[model samples]
Target chain A: MTADILLQAVIGGLLMGLIYALVAAGLSLIFGLMDVVNFAHGELLMVAMFATFSLWQLTGLDPLMVLPLVVVLMFALGVAIYHGLIARALTVQFNRGMVQIFVTFGLGIFIRGLAQFFYGGEFRSITGGMVANRTVQMAGIYVPLPQFAASLVCLGAFALLLVISRTEFGRALEATREDRDAVALIGINRDHIFAIGWGLGAATVGIAGVMLATFYYVSPNVGANFATIAYVTVALGGFGSLGGALVAGLLIGEIEALTALVLEPSLKQVGMFVVYLAVVLFRPRGLFGRL
Target chain B: MEAIPDNAITRRRRNELRCALAVLVVLAILPLPISDVYTQNLIILTLFYAGLSQAWNILGGTCGQISLGHAFYFGVGAYTSTMLFTHLGIPPTLGMFAGGAMGGLMALLIGWPCFRLSGHYYVIATFVVGEIGSLLFLNWDWIGGASGLYIPFHGESWINLQFRTAKLPWHYLFLTFAAATWLVAWLIDGSRWGFAWRAVRDDVVAARSLGVSVFRSKMAAAVISGFFTGLGGALYGQFVGYIDPDSMMTGSLSVLISLPAVLGGVGTLWGPVVGAAILIPVRELSSTFLGGSGRGVDLMLYGAMIVLVALARPQGLVSLLALVRGGRNARTA
Candidate 1:
């Protein structure tokens, strides 16, 4: 009986982990390429979730169907933010680190405030036809349909990212990551590449956001939880390592789920953080991360 | 080194003179005649944040260690000192140091492993410390778990630092701590260790080549910062006379500690002080004007301010002040 519960926890966690992978992958890309932490990444996700909530309420559109629109909107916003804000910041490298941090952190809080301002703190979600309240019964175990859809979305997003990065645009981003000056010297638009990287990063969160609304409550504080968890995911997977983020996300999800099953649910997050510590201490490079 | 430019130096000194006088005049007389309990409470809160942020600046603003888990020390200090006062009837004045010591020890223990990692990894380690501390506080039977520990409201004693009256004591005490922290920042600015810290901040490899033990230096910084922050925590708990894990150890508290330093112009002596001066008032205003969602509104406004600040004066108010002072072109090692 214990074994069965543990297996269920693992499976459930892995599914959630895949979604985390989607969230962190874009973050890793931006960090790897431009070295921008995008402290507002989770907020971006929150914004997307809010958007989905609005769209669902108005048009009764399925959150999944709205994913592409959210991605487009977020991508454009990311580009604008990079050009308007981040570009000005790169001028002085001296205090750039703190500047970036405070800038993004402030942006995050501001976004949350905006959500609270407009949304009025009510929890909203995109619950379409069968997926909203329906559960899938598999071998006497019940799994929410939204959870499964979220996982599929996670896998799809990851696959899409893998392809993009392996393609020309991705190669250019990798080149930019290696050295901005060299990339510029080779006549590549490094700034443009960085903007694209940010856009891509934001777009991924858009995808993650809409899916999150399908299964989870969307509110002003929605991103707060994701923000820390993403940090843990990115750290556990190693900074700037996409593959490591993918694996770490799943692992954390599994750990959180299993811990919740055995212990109190609130403590599951605490357990994930402990795992993050242990991973950082013992294997800072992460399981699949490149040195 | 270039020939000591006496004339230019004196001119810069004169520029700083006006600014310093203005600040001193404001600080000296502002507390007087403001017997309004609300203003006193705001002042006390401002100074509390100023002290915490200044202590945080020692490591984060200076070395760029980016500690998001600083509340670990704050929560620990608050809990420990409060526990001693409540359970053992020990005076909090002495118990505060005990809290600081425990916080310092934890920092060393945690920092030892974390300092080995770079950048975001270090941040995650700090976050974990905070969560673990929260977990311990919540689950442990002793010292009041999730329900929280309350310092005695009836105990009106200076030794225990408890008072039944208004916010005057808290205002004065926190202001003193803030002043002391600034004094320490000034001392650090001229110290050999300060030079080493700046070196480590600018270039670790070069500093390492000069025989500066990078790990030891960072660890020292973490401990120093943690110690004062723990003291701030203890004082905060005393003022409120209530301590809880969530209020003390969460990221919200972490943001409160770090924001002032960032807003004030990090890596400078007066950065946190300026941050507290500017940001806290805005927060209070937003809270009053906005209401119910005042906290949320403040966050949005604060965020917009940060983005604007980053875009325009990324170095913050102190750096801008330094520029206006016409200090010889800012130099970085």
Candidate 2:
């Protein structure tokens, strides 16, 4: 029975870890592309979730059906943010780093406020969605169908990202990441690449948001908690490394699950934090992060 | 590189001291005429945040380490003093010092490992550490847990730092606190340690090559910054008369502590005071007028202002003072 319970936790953790990997990938992509860490990355996820919720409410469509629309909307938002705020922030003469941090932070607060203004602070969940309240039995362990599907979708998204890396646009992105200024010498518009990078980052997170909306609760404050986890994942995975994000996400998810079983459920996050601190102290650059 | 003459530096320091003293005097008298509790409360909050922001500036601005987890120290300070008073029958006035010491200790502990990481890694580590702290506190039942601790009424007393019927006392107390922080900053501005800190902040590699101990410099700044922030937290706990994990240690509180310094002019002596002076009033008034309905209009306005200021005045609002002085003294007014 104990072995069964442990096995169940491991499966559950891996499923959740996949979703975390997707979220962290978006952040890692943006950071890798430009040394800018998007403080508002989670808010983008929140917006996507809300978009999915709103669409479902309006048209009676399944969250799966609304995923494409939400992804497109989030992509537009990501581009708009780059041109409207980040572009200007990058040009500031003094306190460039501080300015970038606050600009994105302020944008996040503004987004959260806007969400609260429109939707109040109540927690809303999709009640009768396609995967609602369903469980799959596998070898004496029960897995929630919604989470299982979300993990699969996230893995597929990761594959798509890998596929994109072989395309012309991906080459431009890699070259830009290598040396943004040098890429300009080769006729690559750095600004245009940055905007597209932001869009791609947002779209990836949007995919995760739509999947999460199928199972998770939707609220104005939901993003804050997930954002914290994403930060930990990114740092632990080594910032800007997609593979690092995946491995670290799974590790964190497993640690969290085991901690919940050994300690109280409320203290589950402590395990992940402790592990992150330990790893960071030993290897300052994280496991896979490049200098 | 031409070195600034000793007399010129001394003259600037003296001028700053005189201006600061004059401003304090004016503030000390300004609250006297306003008998209204609301305005007095606003002034008190502004002064309190001014002090807190100044404390944050020590490490965040002067030392060039951006910690998004200061709420950890604040919460630690609050919990330490509150627990001392409630369980051990100690007066908060003395307990506050203990809280400050604990705050410093915590900073050293956190900084020991975190100082190795630079830039975003360091920032995220601080943030995560803070979250860990708040979560742990929330679950721990010994110090009242999520329900929080309420200070019992012991009537009005200077020793206890509690006053039920007087806004005037709180205003003066906070003013004194803010003045103390400002005084400390002024002293640090000309000290040898200050120059070393600035060097480390500007470029660690260069500073190290120049024989400056980067790790020790950051640790020292962290200890001092944590001490003051924790002290401010203890005072805030007393003022509010209640303490909880959410109230004392949330991520938003950490951001709020840093915002004033960021907005006014990071690393400048007067930046926190000016930023708090403008920010607290706007925050209080907007929340009272627009946020009462909970429609989040006040938050929207607040966020928008931060974005606008950060974008428009990257050097901070204090630089505007330089601009107004004909732009002759641009870097440090």
Candidate 3:
């Protein structure tokens, strides 16, 4: 029985971890390239989830079906945020770093507050999601169908990201991050790359939102719930590496779930935070992050 | 010619002191006419934040290490005194110092490891530390768990730091803290420690080459900043008479604490106070305008303000004053 429980916990953790990895990828990409940590990344995720929820509620469509629509809308958000806030923050001369932090932090507050104002602070979910209620029984372990589907979608998204990152455009984007002046000398506009990076970052969260909406509740404050974990995942995975984020996310989820079973359920966050602090202290570069 | 420059420097210092004193004096008298509890409450909040921002400025402003998690120290202070009062019947005046020490310990725990990470990465480390703190507090039932601890209303006494009826005492108490914090920051701004911090801020490699222990200096600044922030938290606990992990030391509170220094001016003594002055009023007006329970609009406004300020005016509100003063000086010359 104990073995079965542990197995389930591990599986559950992996499932949740995939979404977390996907979530952190967006943040990592933006921070890696632009040097602007969008404190509003999670908020954008929340908005995308809300959009997914709204789409389902209105059109009575499946969560997966709404992915393309949500992705487009989220891309617009990412681009808009870049043009509107991130671009300006990057160019500002004095204390540009501090200014960038405030810009994003403020944007976070603004989005969260607006979400609450419009949505009324209540948690809502897609009750009619295609697969949430159904569970598959495999060798005495139950895997919820919605979670399974979400995991599959998350895998697909990660693979797509891999494909995108290896393309000629991806190389150019990377070149911009490596050396802006060097890239510009080679006739590449870093500004456009940064905007695209931000857009991709926001869109990554949008995809996470779609998968998440299938199984998790969405609310204005929901962004806060996921943000810390995403940050921990990104930091642990070593800042700029997508694969590292995926591995770290799974590890964290497993740790959280296993700790809950071994010690106490309430201390799940405590366990993760301890690990996060320790990792940051020991390896500031993170698992795969460039020093 | 050398004596003339010295005389001019002294005169400028004197003028600055005079301006600071004039502002404080005006603040002290202005509370007299405001008899309403709400207005007094606003003054108390403004001053409390003013103090909190100054405390943040010590590390964030001077040392160039942006701590997004000073709320951890604030929570430590609030919990220390309140816990002592709730469990052992100790008054907050004595407990406040204890709280400060506890906050220092907390800072040490966070700063020791986090000093390795520079810039926004360090900020992220602070956030994680704060998360751990609140989570621990949330689980520990002895501190009242998630429901949080409440300080019972005792009769009015200066020693206990308890005042039941009027907001005047609370206003002045916070005012003293705000003023004292400013004084501390001013002193630090002039002291060797402040120089060390600025040295680190400008260039860590250069500062290290100059034989300065960048780690030790940053750590010292963090400890002092944490201690003062804890003291401020102690005052906030006494005045509010209630505390919770979320309200006292969570992520939101951390953002609120950092905003003042960021918006006001980090290194400048007057910048934080001025930022608090502007924000507190804006906070009150927005909440009122939105009709008591307007969800998210106030936050949106604050967000808009931060973004606008950061993008257009990274120098903070104090820079505007400097510009005006420079213009005046130019015209006079």
Candidate 4:
């Protein structure tokens, strides 16, 4: 492959990886605190994307401008779902792992179905004039403006989450993660904290989703595809480590993008999984995963 | 009553024989009476899933190792047999056995390193194996890459099991396979090895303390599980006459085998049968109308069922049914 093409792919992959980190960081947050792997996390992002799509359609609001509304709505939805179904089920005698997986998976499907029913299956994009189409040329490599914006947003969110986790509330979240029972003995309302964590996680992905929609097409099945990638990223980063998730997400994006330059675009996913499996074999705890 | 002991024993034996006869009769009559193409297709699909799920149950349901990547074996089996038949002119019937051998061997390769980890690690390893298979199949130009491969059509061939007739032959073949799977599952459940498996699943450390070869037991489970799943792949390829990477290796297909068993009752004889009965029809109906919309309708419904069942009744409907039957038996006794 030509140096320019390879360099472009690496940059593209790195940008995609940042977005993956954003999505996966939310997954890490929810999974870390509640021990619930939300299969519908991607669907939450899909919903956010659709929300932005609708707002852009009706009020002509830009996707970036609609981020706050998307985050709030998704956060509320996540909290509601956690309280309504998940919390109660965790107390019961059952296969919590598979059951939660299915529950979230079901929610994902339902959301996707609703999206299809309301919006149809046509690919939807929230494009706004020259910025949407504009690309910067650096050393013979083209970088789309939207992608660059998404990367910036991703990094910004990561920093904000880092700050939140270090605060008192964030410490409670850490305590919640270390031991749910111990967290309760210390007078913390674990359930409420968990709900908040889940909400934040969902809301974070909501921002990622809108950014994704800006760069690519929005469809019902898009969430499922991205969810699998998110799962791969989570596993690669170590399940509950946010920093690990970010690093793993970026790594996957870079690998996929770089591979796509030399190999068929579809085979890029193959490359992503190859790296994931290799990580699992050699370093099961992930790059920054706790032993 | 004391004077008629011989007669009582004979009567009990006769009753057992009658129940067996009735089951045979039902299985025989199912395909013949159903003429509707959709209904027949659904039944055949159910039987195919029943067999596949039963095979999956050995590892996932029985051993409590939830593997979402059983399709690795399934894909390997499909590609191996299809390739053999098309390229080397080997009969698919023979190729199927060879395919199963390959799958079983591959399981041994992966299972050795994976089974050492306690919980969820095995699940992750299995998922990786499946992804690897999918990747290799998708990228390797030898297997047509992402474009996929198609088996040549046949008018009538005993060797190929290809026919231009109705779905009757395929239906019978799959049904026979399902019954064989049930029989094998029952045998394993009752065998000494089955007890060892239960011990390992319940507590590996305890089983090891008791001198059970936990590693060997799990490997055996994986091998057997992979063998039958491979058989499923062979059957799937021949029936559809086309094998693509996505259809063969996707998580959705893996769900077809595992979800039913999970819903029915893992580690139980009738789990696959029950799961197939409930899920196959629903899946068919959903795919018929709602599948093409690219919406998550089918998946949502399927996931809801799994979650509800897992939370409300982890033992599944089969176990519940067994409990009812068991109560009646106790009362009679």
Candidate 5:
């Protein structure tokens, strides 16, 4: 009897884990390249969700249809945030390290405030979307339609990342991560590569946001939830490792889902936080962290 | 070692004594003239923040370990005292110290594993741990769970720390803590432990080579910081007469506590007080005037201020004061 509940939880967690992986991948990539933890990353996802929600309200386009627009817009915004704020902070000379951390955090607050200011503090949810209220039955189990679409999008993001890595830009980004000074010597522009990485990292939130619009509620503070989860994922997965984020994201999802299955649903977050603490305490570099 | 001239040292000490006295006079008298509950509460809240931020400043400013989870300690302060008072019928006056001890112990437990990380990793770890603590508190039904524990208010009594009319008692209590926090920080600025903390903060590798135990110093800073902050929390909970996990132990509270130190100056003794002095009034005013529909405006301003400080003047507003004073006084010296 409990087998059905267990199977459902496992399948549900697996589906969710992939999306978590997608959300965290950008943060991992950004840390991987720049060592700059994008503290405002979850805000970017929040912005993307709002963009998709607004598109639905105004133009009558579903989140799936508005995904491209949100992605492109978020990418541009991410680029601007970096060059405008982060770049300025880096040039401060003496206390660059502390300044770098707080700049993103400050930006995070500012963005959340902007969202609240413009949209008001009310929680908004999309009324109808491409993948709403539909599910598929497989072997006496049902799969939510939007979540299925979300998993597909997650896969697409990974494939796209794979494709991107083979490109010159990815190589430049990798080089920059390896040695910023050496890359500067090689005639490949460090600024462009880093900015693009930042932009792409932000753009991935678009994929996450559009999916979340189908299933979750949207508010200014919603970003804080995803932001913390993403940070935990990045930390658990090993800072700066995309593949690790993917695996760790799934593992966290599984733990969370399994904990909910066995224990109270309210305490589900305990599982991942404990795991994250263990990771930070014992193997901070994480399982697949680079030597 | 270079020795200071007797006259010069006395002159500086006299000037410092005068400044402290002037501040003391102002704080002592501010609530006297203002009988309005709103203004009194604002002063108490602002001072509360000042103390909390200074507590944060110990680890954050002195050791350069930015913890986004001090709220966990704050919540612990509130919860620990509330539990002791509610379960054992012990007065909050005595419960305050016990709560502080709990906070210190919690800080040690949290910081022991956390100090291993530095920079971004450390921040993330602290953040996770804070959330973990908060989640555990929220789920545990033994401590009143999500509804939060409420401290019963009695007729105006010193032991109960409750008042029927005047807010002066609470204001004085808060002022005392803030002043104590400032004084402790001032003392630590000259102590060997303080030197060790600053040494480790400035350069851990160099500090280690200089025979400083980076771990021990950070642990001490965190413990003391949490202990004092927990005391402030007990005062805050008693002053407010209610306690909740979400309200006390959340990221927003963490950010609120740290913002003052960030805006004022991370490493300075009086930065938290000065930062709170400047920002809290603005926050209070914004929330009062534009707060109804324009919610998040205060937060937006805070965010902007943080970004402004980080990008423009990482030295903090206290440095600006110092710059002005030094600029003017340079001619005399």
Candidate 6:
């Protein structure tokens, strides 16, 4: 019975870890492309979740059906952000780094305000969706269908991201990351590549958001919690490393699950934080970070 | 960078000191006519943030360490004093310094490990550490946990730092606090440590190569910054007469403490004062009018202003003063 309970926790952790990986992947992609950490990344996730909620509420479509639309919407948002605020922030002659941090941070607060203005801070969940309130029992372990399906979809998104990384656009992105100025010399429009990278990053997170909306509660402040976790994952995996994000995400997931079992569930995040601090303190550049 | 003559630096410092004294004198009398509690409260808050932001500027601005987790120190100061006052029968006036000491010690503790990482890594680490702190505080039942600790009103007394009938005392108290922080900044501005810190901010590698101990410089800045921030937090707890994890240690509070310094101009002595003067008033007024129903219009406006300021004047609002004076070059005050 003890072994069964442990197996159940492991499976639950892995499933959640897959979704965490997708979220961190989006962050890692943008950071790798341009040394900018999107402080507003979580708000983008909140927007996607809210979009899913609104679409389902309006058209009676399941979250799965609305995934594509939400992805497109988020992609546009990502590009618009890059063009509107980030572009100007990059040109500042004084305090360039501080400018970028505050600009994105301010954007995040603005987005959160918009969410609260519209949604009224109430926690809303999609009820009666395809995966809601269902559980799959396999090999004497039980898993919620919403989480299981979300993990599967997140895994597929990871595969898609991997595939994209192997394409021509991917080569352009790699070259830009290597040297932004050098890429411009090679006939690549650095600005265009940056915008597309933001879009791709947004789209990946959008997929995760839509899946999470199937099970998780949605609210104005919901993104803050997830954003912290995403930051930890990225930092632990070593910033800008996709493979590192995957491994770190899974590791964090298992740690969280085990911590919950051993300690109080309310302190689950404490375990992940401790592990992150330990790893970063020893390595100084994270487990897999190059810079 | 060309080295300025010693007399010129000394003259600038003297001018700055005179200017600061003049401003304080004007501020001291400006509040006498206003007896309305609302406006008085606003002035006090503005002064409080001015002080808090100055503390943030010491490390974040001068030393070039952008800490998003200062709420930890702020919370530490608040909790330390409150617990001492409530549980041990200790007066908060003394407890305040104790809080400041703890805050500085905590900064050293956190800085010990965090100083190893730089750039985005350090920023995130501070942030996570803050969250860990608040979370732990939220669960620790000994300190009242999430229910929060409420200071029992022990009537009006300067020793206790509590007042019931008038807001005037708090205003002057906070004004003095703000001026004290400004004075410290002024002293640091003229000191060798000031040059060392700016060097670290501009380029750590070059600073180290120049025989400046980069780690010690950052750690020193952190201690001083955390100490003043903690002092401010103790004052805040006494003024509010209540303390909670959400109110004292949230991520938003951390952002609030740093925003003024960022907006006014990081590393500038006058930046926090000017930024807080503008930001705290606008924030308070907007929230009073628009945040009543919790629609978040106030938040939206505040966020928009930050974005606008950061994008339009990256050097800070202080530089705009230089522009108005038509100075070809602005000295780093």
Q: Tell me what TM-score chain A of model 3 achieves.
A: 0.97
Badly placed stretches (over 4 Å) of model 5 are B1-18
The DockQ values of the predictions, listed in order, are 0.61, 0.81, 0.77, 0.40, 0.70, 0.84
Best by DockQ: 6
Model 5: pairs clashing at backbone N, Cα or C within 3 Å: none
Query: What does candidate 2's lDDT look like per residue over B1-333, in tens digits?
Result: 998788999999999999998998999899888989998999999999999999999999999999999999998998899899988989999989888888999999999999999999999999999989999999989998899899887999988999998998899888988999899888989999999999999999999999999999999999999999998889999999999999899888989999999999999999999999999999999999999888888888898999999999999999899787766656466
lDDT of 4 by residue, B1-333 (tens): 448676775675556457545755687788897889888889889989989999999987667677878898998898889999899989888988888887787778878867765454456567766877787788888988888899997567768979666888888888877887777777677567888898988888898999989989999989989888888898889888889888999776776678788788778777788888898888788878777766656655665666666667766778787789899999999
Name the better of 3 and 6 by DockQ: 6
lDDT of 2 by residue, A76-188 (tens): 99999999999999899999999999999988988988999999989998876788789999888899999998999999999999988889999999999999999999999
Q: Supply candidate 5's per-residue lDDT for A260.
A: 90
Over B1-333, each residue of candidate 1 has an lDDT whose tens digit, in order, gives 779776875665555456555765676577888988877778778887888899999988776688888998998888878888888878889988888877777788888888988766676678767877788788876777888887887567778788778566666778778877776766676667888888988899999999888998889888888888888888889888788888988877887798888878888878898888888877877777775654477667777887776667767777777686565544431
Candidate 4 TM-score versus the reference: 0.91
Off by over 4 Å in 3: B1-11, B291-294
Interface RMSD of each: 2.1, 0.8, 1.4, 2.8, 1.6, 0.8
Accuracy of chain B in candidate 3 (TM-score): 0.95
Residue A168 error, candidate 3, Å: 1.1
How does model 6 score by TM-score?
0.98
Q: In model 2, what is the error at residue A189, expressed in angstroms?
A: 0.3
Which CAPRI category fits model 5?
Answer: medium
Q: What share of the true interface contacts does each candidate keep?
A: 0.70, 0.72, 0.86, 0.46, 0.79, 0.78
Query: How well is each residue in A1-291 modelled by candidate 4, as lDDT tens digits?
Result: 677777777898899999998898898888778778887877888888888888878888778888888889988988998897788667756566666765666667667767777777888787773357779887677899899988998999999998998899999989888888988888999899988987899888988997887878887777877877888898889888998889899899988887777677766787888777777777776667665
C-alpha local distance difference test of each model: 0.81, 0.92, 0.86, 0.81, 0.85, 0.92
* Candidates 1 and 2, the one with greater TM-score: 2
